[model samples]
Target chain A: MEQGLSNALNVLIVGMATVFMILWLVVIIGNLIIRVTNKYWTDEDLKKSAPKSNHPSASKGAVAAIIAAVEIVTNGRGKVTKITKQ
Target chain B: MDIFSKLFEMTAFGIVTYKTVIMWAIAFLLLFLGIKKKYEPLLLVPIGFGVLLANFPGADMGIVAAENIELPDGHYKNLFEIAHDYGILNYLYYALIKTGFLPPIIFMGVGALTDFGPMLRNLKLAFFGAAAQIGIFSVLIVSMLLGFTINEAASLGIIGGADGPTAIYTTIILAPHLLGPIAIAAYSYMALVPVIIPLVANLLMTKKEFKINMKQMDKLYPPKHQIKNIKTVKIVFPIVLGTVVAIFVPSSVPLLGMLLFGNLVKEIGSSTSRLAEAANGPIMNTATIFLGLSVGATMTSEVFLSPKTLGIVVGGFIAFAISIAGGIVAVKVYNLFAKKKINPLVGATGLSAVPMASRVANEVALKHDSNNHILQYCMASNISGVIGSAVAAGVLISLIGG
Candidate 1:
């Protein structure tokens, strides 16, 4: 039982350390790759080609239009309580 | 002699055993779950039917025969003469599964289907994926204490990842005998994520926590400024990450290589769309069917009824639960330092069931507050769980696999 506990503790430390190390590296390198790509090859066409529906601007734009309609209907008296995307 | 006696001797009824009856009932239960409950129908239906075929009296549709010999490349070479060697499912199992060829191809399909944008957008959430894998090692210890050898323990531990293919891959390498239970447990828990995650999360988190809105992430980074060249980043990520991972753990290269290869095909656009279609469509479907059938057929009564099989089933659930908790705990730890609080529910999605885990997180979030949409954040951890599991499997293989 003691031996098993020892082994489990060893695995807990080493296994977790390795996993965090690998993922930490992934996070760093992943960010670095994006930064480098953004710096060196900012292709406007490719950037435009990327889908934009999930972006804040897209959601905000939809909200702005709704707010404009609401303000007109209420003669600028009503205020937007909340704006959230489903 | 008597004609009736002769006919009876040749019939399946004569050969049927109690074990066959039990296995058939089990198969029917799986079919019920797949059809009625809609629990992973894509896999369970085929697997359930395969179980029926395998348990049929006098059918000999088992994926393995007593006379089959394993070859160097993991193919089962039938040496019991051609007359007895022509089991169709056995051929499929040996040709595809026994050679260890199917899982990587499945990963390729998964790669083609996945979008890395969510993970890229929220890199911090990626660590939650790794954190969830604590269940793997934790389970490994428990399994070892229960008398499983290191290899068997490793195979069983991977169920924590919630990634079926990685679980299957690790099992095939470390403990082929436990493949049936391990695969069943992995996929079963994956299907039950909608039920399981909420159960675990509700226990760990308060209603306020579940309702904690992360829509503010949109304001924090503003999706437009997140990444301008997502295409280039997506294309570069797999290549660079795959190389780094392979250099660190060469045993993982096969699965990671095919995964990255498929992703490259997808990201390259129209020129490679045909290849991507093949990888994610017919080829992927074919692999899934064969994988399901072979894995199901491999679970004959003698192999399936063991005490260890039951242990694997129990251990797998524990592993999965622990992984979910691990991710949540990691988020709590991360919250100690960070200004913005991440919904710990997103951490629960660190398991690699992909969109299912993320969707469940979203649903649970909606239950507390309707407008909350953490699906995008959940996806970051969800996708990272795949890579984390694959790497964990590699590490286990290096440390314990024979």
Candidate 2:
């Protein structure tokens, strides 16, 4: 009984530790892959217009309402060639 | 030979033993559980029917190998005679089961149906799945103290994993003699998780803990920005994980490899739709029937009636209970440091009963608070439990079998 108890203890520790180890590695690697992929591959349209600046309400960042104004002045046909942050 | 004598000889009463009658009763109970109770009917109905067929006096449907056949060198004239003597079920047992083929195929099907997005999203929550394996080790100790051999105890211990394929695979490798009872016990307790997990959770945790709504936990810590283009990571994960596991514990490769391969087929998107459908449908269902029946057929009067079988059944239940507690305990520990508190009940879902365990967790949380939609969160641990059990089985096979 004592020997079995000791062996069982070994299994408990080792088994738990191994599971954690493998999964922890997976977690770390998974995060790394996601991080790397996202870093290199932000979408082109999202990059073209700053999400923070483009919202009509504009409570936070500097507004680029100039893009809408440009479209209106062009009779809804013109693309805003460029906008510089002031 | 009188006509009456021939009639008497053909009757079941003529060859029935007390043990045979007891086996029949057990078979009937399994049938009731499967058909009437609707408990794991896919497996239980077949197993129950197998038990019934095997118990019939003159059917010769039992999975016994041929007896008293001696082989002397290459010139084997009696090979056909030996083949004729073998039971029909024994052929299935040797072909699909004895070589350890069916369980891995079943895992492939399971993998095809699995979605790893949840586990990948919350990697920290996944460790609770590992913690749930504490039940397997605890039962291993008890079984050993009760005089089971180390291999036999290892087989008994894995029943706590709550993943039928893992339990079946481990038992077939370590202690094939105990496979029938272990498989039955594993599946039976899995069906009982709705009752068992809540009892353990209620005992260990307070009512407030059960009501910890993770969906509302964004108040504690702001949710992280969701990552984009996750498909690339999903495709790569199973292959990388499978490689690492196989490299570390080669014995686990067959089961884990097939599982990851199946997932790969599913996630690769549109290219392998036919293969994926076949793997998760017909292949899986066929394997389940053969596997269930062969496992049931192994439970002859002598084997299933033994005291050790009782110990295995009891030990399996304890292992399952302890596993639930272990997951809950791990979640409590995780809650201590994390900025956002998880519903500790999610921990109880960290056994590999898949959507069933996750559904039970969701149901329990909904009972406490209707708006607590933590199914996705609970699924993280549930899927992790599958991999965790496979790894634990591998460790046991390596440590003890070595």
Candidate 3:
């Protein structure tokens, strides 16, 4: 029983330390990956690669009106990507 | 009279005992919970049915321990002979589960189904997932003090992970005898995430803490950087993280490696969509069926009707409660120093129950203030809990099983 208790204590210390160490590394590396990717891969690049709508682009008046509505509704947090007729 | 005696001997009723009847009642309870309550039905139904089959008299359907199988020649029966004598369930239990093969395959499917976007967006919250794992190790010490062997204690402690595959995998390595009880405890508590999360949260958190609006906090203290190309980042993430984790804890590679591989296929889009679909669909479903049945088959009348099983049930519940409270406390501590406060519900969600724990936390937050939506933030910690638990399992396996 003494041996078992000691071993359990060892596991408790080693297990928690290892788990925290590994997961902390994951957080740091994850942040680094995000920063490096964002630095090299700009939003403009994403926009360029984005698939074009099969239908033609909406008229300037319709596009402006839709953008205005979205801006109001989302308080400038939303962006218009595609406009299609129902 | 002679013919009547012979016929009676042929019937199962002649051999059925009170133990067998008790096991059947237990099986029926599981089935009722699965079919009626709809609590993790996909797994519980098969497991319940398997338990019933295992306990049936005269069927010999229960999984037999290797040493228990002897032949007339005084030599142990080989795999073929064991299959011939026992049943297919025994064969599967030995081949798939004893070898620790199925759980990682199920994990691969889980990975394909996961989206790590929320976690990546809120990187700081991932620490709570690690904090929540305090329950697993804490339980290990308590179980040992309660007279369980170190191996058995490790198996019992993993229930705190709240991940069925991780628990089963650890049990298979450290203490195969405890697999049945450990698997049942893990899954049952996972299904009870809705009940358990709220219970723990209410005990640990205040109303104001629950009403902390994550959206307002985000606006006031915005993230320093934005993921401009999320697709590329998602694809690269699993690879980098997998490599780093494998280096630190090589024992985790089997489960974590396959998980990252599945996620990679899913994130790669059209090229590997077929692989992802196959992984999350047919492959995962088949593994769940076999896993549930084989695990349940291990729960024979002789094995499961022990005082130890009762300890596992109680210990597993305490593990869940402690893990939940750990997460909530971590968030509260973080709030003390940080200007941007996190709702304690986000911390309470640091369990590996996937969307269920996150959803429960979201509901609790919404109850306090309807507009305080924190599902995405909760997910950030919840997903990290999955990784944290898997890593913790690996550490236990390496330290004890090795």
Q: Enumerate the candidates' DockQ scores in order.
A: 0.24, 0.22, 0.36
Fraction of true contacts kept, per model?
Answer: 0.56, 0.51, 0.76
Candidate 2 on A1-86: residue-level lDDT in tens?
68767877797788778877877776777777678667875444344564444335554323446654655466446665444455
Score candidate 1 by DockQ.
0.24
Q: Model 1 Cα displacement at B260 (Å)?
A: 1.7
Which segments of model 1 are wrong by more than 4 Å? A1-9, A45-86, B65-86, B217-225
Model 3 agreement with the true structure over B342-397: per-residue lDDT tens digits? 99889888889899999989998988999999999999999999999999999999
Clashing pairs in 3: none
How high is each candidate's TM-score? 0.87, 0.87, 0.92
Select the stronger candidate by DockQ from 1 and 2: 1
What tens-digit string does per-residue lDDT give for candidate 1 at A1-86? Answer: 67766766676677778778888878988899988888877877643443344446556457657665776567556656555468
Residue-by-residue lDDT tens digits, candidate 2, B1-402: 699898998887788999999999988998899999998999988888888877888877776632333346534324355347656577677678877999999999988999999988877778888888889988888888899988899999998999898999898888888888898899899888889988998899888988998867865675565667577778888988888888877877777889998899988855576688899999999999999888888888877899998898899999999999999998899889887888888899889899898898889888988998889999999998998898888899888877
- Which residue ranges in model 2 land beyond 4 Å of their true spot? A1-5, A41-86, B65-83, B223-225
Write down the lDDT of every candidate, Cα atoms only.
0.84, 0.83, 0.88
Q: Number of the top candidate by DockQ?
A: 3
Q: What is the TM-score of chain A alone in each candidate?
A: 0.49, 0.46, 0.57
All candidates in order of DockQ, best leading = 3, 1, 2
Task: List RMSD in Å for every model shown.
Answer: 8.8, 8.4, 5.6
Arranged by TM-score with the best first, the candidates are 3, 1, 2
| lDDT winner between candidates 1 and 2 | 1
